[model samples]
Target chain A: MSPRGRRPAGSPDAREAILAAARTAFARDGYRTSLRGVARGAGVDPALVHHYFRDRAELFAEAVVASAAGTGAVDISERAQAISRLAPEELGEGIVRSFVGLWDGLGGDRFSAVIRAAMSNDESLAPFRDFIVTGILGNIMDKLAPDRPELRGQLIAGQLIGFGVVRWLARLDEVASLDIEEAVALIAPTIQRYATGELPSSAA
Target chain B: MSPRGRRPAGSPDAREAILAAARTAFARDGYRTSLRGVARGAGVDPALVHHYFRDRAELFAEAVVASAAGTGAVDISERAQAISRLAPEELGEGIVRSFVGLWDGLGGDRFSAVIRAAMSNDESLAPFRDFIVTGILGNIMDKLAPDRPELRGQLIAGQLIGFGVVRWLARLDEVASLDIEEAVALIAPTIQRYATGELPSSAA
Candidate 1:
């Protein structure tokens, strides 16, 4: 085996390095990025990258999730746990604050990179969408909503994703320029309602 | 002048054709798309494309706005006018219905194309963002909102844009699968609140 592939598949450091490299690669190249390039960036052999990830889609999903989790900052499970613990009334603000905080910390360029990569094609889009809908939003709604948690979670995800797209990706001036606190205040109630409020009569 | 460039710069049909072709080209090639390609697609000379649009960025912005307006359906200004005429209580539902109707009419692939083009780069992003923030959302807020119309408009835009992104672009299963009425029913109240309700004390 080549020295680059000599690292054990079980090595956490090698795995993490590959993910980090994948994030950078996806950000730079979007959906069309190749596994071989990712391996080169990580200084690992192509075989090692394949051994670590079943395919580019898996790597892209995990990289994006890792990036969303803020890499070395706060673990995603911890963040989800924190959100799950919020009182129903506070859920909106908690969710908004947590997402804004993470996005802000990740910085605009990195956040936009993830969005651009996700927008590139269907293959890339599915995993990213799944992560947002199922992994983050659904996980929260499952814990807190009284009815149709799946739908409710998707609704909340839509709002939050819109906020991120407007503020970070699209960089719409009004919302993008707002103080984070102000933004949270403006958006939280809507989120709170989605989390624990009533739906339209027909919807209910 | 060559036959392609011979069409008077004042011809409305030529301008519309160029805009349509620009939309297709941008959707295919994104931010880096060349004006020459758009001209070719429209069967016009590059100079004529420049005559109608100052540059590529302007072409991108106009194409996206044209797409958002729903090429053959209700003109954007008419839709905005209809929204403007709504009573305050009906604003949220009206806004949601209008957007969903337009998006539904435009179909998923076209909507995704505009989004993907917008997400491609900053040069392409600004004009699209301005249209949503200033042109569509801001125009509606200015007519009806009592205070901080710009901010209120943005908030509403965020929700609507999020709805479109989740439903059309990302195609999240829960939200994407929703019938138009159900999706609107779930989201309209929040938009209405943004349009007319009191914001958080600090925000106000």
Candidate 2:
């Protein structure tokens, strides 16, 4: 069934409001946020939240995706479209530019909130992990990479995740201070290698 | 003056005790840990912790390094020496192998504690940041890389940090489930390129 078909009849606005409230709560409290608090924030009944989302984990996953796509930041779908348009060789630079832009646009607190929340509790981590591995990177790899797309997507994820941790979360001087272009220049090749370049023979 | 000269004459064991206590406390409470509590854990007066280390930050830093070294896990210094001994082209594989081994040996909890603590507070992040940028990666670059060591080291740091985050912290299946040698084969070349391969012209 279509996702729209699954929804209970009501104004779609309530759903959006709950998602928006969830984004704020998850960003502020990580995974520990309560559905009642989210419902109150959205001015909806707690039962309505349960109506929209199966549980808190589902809510958090939806909230994170909504936060990434719905906030003033660049939309992930649009960003994915932009990435898809780039020549295969240019994918590295395009991905890095898009990633840096997305995070920079989202602001550090929001970005860190996603990571810190994931790190704070393993159960909370599952949705974010799925969002990253399958929803984002894996989808990109499936479209673009020629071989071993799963590994390629994962390697790219590792590079980008590390870049975010070092530059944004850890705020290391050498990396955190680099201008976007400089970072793109230095990191894009590595990503390019992961995305399309030849990898060493796997021992496994 | 020598470090020993500054210390009050006493058994060397007290200094070690404070550091051990600090490691446990920092791992448990992160940067929010207090000197009095660490001192209590060590069976030493808070004044004694002050005498051995300048402040909480320094103590935390020392404790981290010591934990990396003193635990049954592989020592950072010895790991560095091993990396230094490898041929330049082999550096990537050696480094990845060492990193995976070290983290695996240290066990996930301790490794996560260091990263989680850093993420918890900006003040706590500084010492760990410095340790990653300067103490470990930068030092490696200085001794081994032929040019642009700072940028190379930072890039390498970003990659390794990402790998750890993805593999250990996030536990994404594609990368996380790989045998260590598989990881080494896939990632080492990327590290090698950053270590010695030609980088794109800097925008700066």
Candidate 3:
């Protein structure tokens, strides 16, 4: 019923306002912020959210990328370009620093909500995860090693986020709370090993 | 009063039985299953689950380990001993198979409960994640090349679980429904690469 977003059903132009609002709400409040919150933030009625998003989950997927993009975090195509210039170790640091910096600067409140929602249920989380791994992580993967990038990228990608989960999300006493300096010293070497170590001799 | 269980407090042995029942019931019905379910399954009064576990979350930790031990799958210590003997690529499959074997067979119902509980929130999930990373994954790390085993192990551990998550939990279209052999074949190469691949020279 809001005047700013009365886009008719199936109209591409109309959904943009809803998406913008959804992203703002999600980034501000996190992925689990209610649809009503998003609608209110957008200045549109909650009905418009359903009209464009079909559900809260879809809106959440929109919000993660949008927030990532807005925060200037480096998972974007730009990160790949920057990553290309660094050594393997530097690359790992660049990736880690950028993500951690973004999350840190962004205030963990938003991220915690996103992570909690993502980890909330398998079904609720999958779409957002797929978009990241495929759209965002996949792009990073493409840049890791052009020859057999899939496997190698996957390895790097796994660690990139996995460490984040352990340190930031899980907050294990020793590993989670490590100062960035200590964390960098500890994990960077390990990542370096992962980035350039010799292949193990067997596949099975 | 049932002979199946002992006194509430100071009875270390009785707590273990309650834990065993909790694991089975949680696995069978997930969050929906109540303390009553655990108690009933254990053949003891509901008070005991609270007495020993403090609540479902505490019970969950005990249940998780007890169920795994109950299943006799992956025999953590034995697997720890054998890790060094394993070909690194094979490591992923072995871990995956161990997880799937437990979920699909012995603790299928119970592990599902554990997984569902993990989906809830950080407080309930942190210990579970830590146990897996510090316990299950850490055990495997011991088998890795010692130089950077923690990093390498973490990387491998994340990817393997990520793969399993896609294949099993999230059940994404591209990955979830694959035949076991096909899934293994598709995923193993990536796992192998991560377990032991030289880092790409970032084209700086």
lDDT of 3: 0.53
Where does candidate 1 stray beyond 4 Å? Answer: A1-12, A15-62, A65-74, B1-74
Q: What is the Cα-based lDDT of residue A199 in candidate 3? A: 37
**For model 3 chain B, where is the 10-residue window of minimal lDDT?**
B195-204
Pairs with backbone N, CA or C atoms under 3 Å apart (clashes), candidate 3: A195-B199, A196-B198, A196-B199, B27-B109, B27-B110
Model 1 DockQ (Cα-based): 0.57
Model 1, B1-204: lDDT tens per residue? 346444465666878788888777765665556778877777776788878665454565567655653454335555776787888888888888888887787787667777786678887776566556544665477554577777778778788878888889888777888888997898888888888887777777
**Which residue segments of model 3 deviate by more than 4 Å?**
A1-62, A65-81, A84-89, A107-110, A189-204, B1-62, B65-116, B126-204
What DockQ, on C-alphas, does every prediction get? 0.57, 0.57, 0.13
Give fnat of each prediction, in order.
Answer: 0.83, 0.78, 0.12
Predicted chain B of candidate 1, TM-score versus the true chain B = 0.69
Give the number of the best model, judged by lDDT: 1
lDDT of 3 at A24: 66
In order, the first chain's TM-score in every candidate is 0.69, 0.68, 0.58
